[model samples]
Target: MLSTVSPRVADPNVRTALVETAARLLAEQEGLTIRRLAHEVGTSTMAVYTHFGSMEDLRRAVRLEGFARLAAHLDAVERSRDPVADLSALGWAYCFNALANPNLYRVMFLEAPIDAEEAESGGATFAPVVAAVQRCIDAGRFTSCDAWSLAVQTWTMVHGMVGVVLAGVFGPDEMLGHLSTMTVSLYVGNGDSRAAAVRSLARARRRMEPHAPIKRSDGAAEFERPRIQNAAP
Candidate 1:
């Protein structure tokens, strides 16, 4: 009979360290080698093998970790009285997740050879956006269009802007303001009244009011989101 056993990692924390270190290094465009990774995590190269099976597996794990973090942020957006406001909050949460984890964000989307499994798994992260859009449609705030399609459209617009900001095309300080502008246009076009869309946008922005773009020592600006309470699953 064949034995079924998972590999034992002497230190579970080492696995987390390896994944995070590799993601940060990959984002910084550092030359990644097994020895370098091991050195950074203060473990032998064998630990990587024990934890992830191989470097390719570790890369996939890193991408999955990025999605996990993103899902957490989306799940943090509570359902509000207005479905439109709730939808806007979901988009903001997605953007804030990327801003907070630029390194992981790059690894999640920019890396090549995205396998079928990884791609499918990553698609799950968009579920909340789709559900939120459906709520808007059900509430008669949006036209009777396909919810998934609109959600994808919204995601594409937001992700494109985020990618540009991450590439230093512009400062992150203007991101929320720009998102508000674009989403209002999108919502209005999809049958929502402009006044109601603006109101929803304002409500969403207010939730993140505790945070603003702050400059790092390197003088780069980044947005921070405060912890929201009573978030629905």
Candidate 2:
């Protein structure tokens, strides 16, 4: 039997516009209404319902969009013989994604409620990080352990720091140095020597610096979030 498709298929351009607008509204702490959202995107109010079913569904879509973009960034990090450096690069990618898409990042983790399948999709996005952790174990940079568990621990450490910076506890300029220190410490705690961890992270940072965001003297970010295409859940 052929799979059934929904009769009300959404235009990808409109979907992208709606999701991006919603994320930005959330970041700016503005109220979201179907009418306002539709007006912002030059569409009818019914278009919101036609595309997303309801506002709650739109929230879920926005979260999934965030994960999709994160997955893309993580997948772009090149692998190398040095597993520790590769792992560090993955961490940097995660950080960059969060920084680049603050509104979507907040929606992904903080604002919205995700259903069971959506939750699974979010986990799938983290697979690259887990794979990097497994590489470290395979190379004996980390002790034999559950790579998923180790990845979770390392991920949460970075996430907490990101949250702090996002909340303005620290400026963006200060985040990289603190992140470097924390990342090296986590690697050392896992089994790598401190010196080796530092060297590995340095390698990754050097590779990342060319593309990293530059902050203006007034604290505005030179890097803005890219418009991401929505992935099917």
Candidate 3:
């Protein structure tokens, strides 16, 4: 005889379990609706709303989590000693992150609506890539282009390659190594002159940072937030 597990125990752990179950189902199943998700997780729609606000909010949270994870991968890539190699590693990390979490990646990069104004305002979300590019500049590895411009150019190259690979425009085996080399070469270049602007911008950002605090919260000490210029294209 199979034992039955009742979900309606009046326990906080039960409620937490329900929310996690629902979140997992959402990630696994694309286009999941609140009602369907509620049923699968053995909870009510009200429970989902209580935990996550709205369906849109839940989606946003999921995408935000994905971006945070991707950011961590990029961060690790940036920590490498070799600047050129770090950039290449970052490109590889981007592709790997997207491929590993396709649905989450779509929600993070493709489906999430990015505000043009927020992007133009140089929001916090774009800081990691900007910081990475700035490092290359400071090291005299790249030309001194503005951080924003270099960030956009470098990001575009990586994003475009990922898009092509995901869209099945190229076979998996054919593009991986070739694209990685090509992307690194494209940005760092055959000569050092191309990166002059990059170095200058990095220096400028470092100098300017002391004057501007990016965000403030109630009763919290003021701190400088890294400025990430809009590179979303």
Candidate 4:
């Protein structure tokens, strides 16, 4: 039911207009100032002040909205017995959120004026990820009883790569390639290598190369995988 519903946005509302305008303006040059944002949204600057109290407040709202959308995405994933796959999916979901909304994601993290409490509270947005890691621990698919730590570590791993790739410093293919092995390392230290997580991540599984259909060392499982071509340079 959560997935079935979109974020409850008040249609044609002044607050949404101002905040949404702020996010878009951030993506373009010479648009962040309140005067330009108001003109672009066909409203007076007073509306922005009235709606958000101040520019800093508007920035914080935009940042939180980005996390809110990501929360919607993580909530949408259907729970299954394949804990590794779900984890992989969440990583991809994290990346997708960044890639699809580069401007919003950037403000949510790099530019937002939120305080330490707001920053710490951002962890709650990833509760679904923590729950998935817990599921892996419960199913004995992963080691380490501290799912919270694993979840935070994994979130850090994925988000770091997302930031790097978006900055154009890292190629998409190279970053995505590292994602599997790096995430696998964490889980391996916890239990079995989660390269098998890739199989369920069709495109990523293919991107893993000749190593696709990774076999368990115990010969307990050999998963056939789907293929994917990474983004071209």
- Which model scores highest in lDDT? 1
73, model 2: CA deviation in Å? 0.7
Q: What is the C-alpha lDDT profile of model 1 across 131-202, one tens digit per residue? A: 999999999999957899999999999899899989988555566667778899999989999999988888
Best by TM-score: 1
- Where is the poorest 10-residue window by lDDT in model 2? 224-233
lDDT score for candidate 1 against the true structure: 0.81
* Model 2 lDDT per residue over 15-82, tens place: 99999899988777799888989999999887888889888888888888999988888888999888
In model 1, the runs with Cα more than 4 Å from the true position are 1-10, 211-233
TM-score of 3: 0.61
Per-residue lDDT of model 4, residues 68-90, tens digit only:
86776666566666777777777
- lDDT, candidate 4, equals 0.68
Q: How many residue pairs clash (N, CA or C atoms closer than 3 angstroms) in each of the candidate models, in the order given?
A: 0, 0, 13, 1
Enumerate residue pairs that collide in model 2.
Answer: none
Better of 1 and 4 by lDDT: 1
lDDT for each candidate structure: 0.81, 0.80, 0.56, 0.68
Q: Candidate 2, 56: how far from true, in Å?
A: 2.0
lDDT of 3 by residue, 88-143 (tens): 55555666566555555655566547445424322443566677777777777766
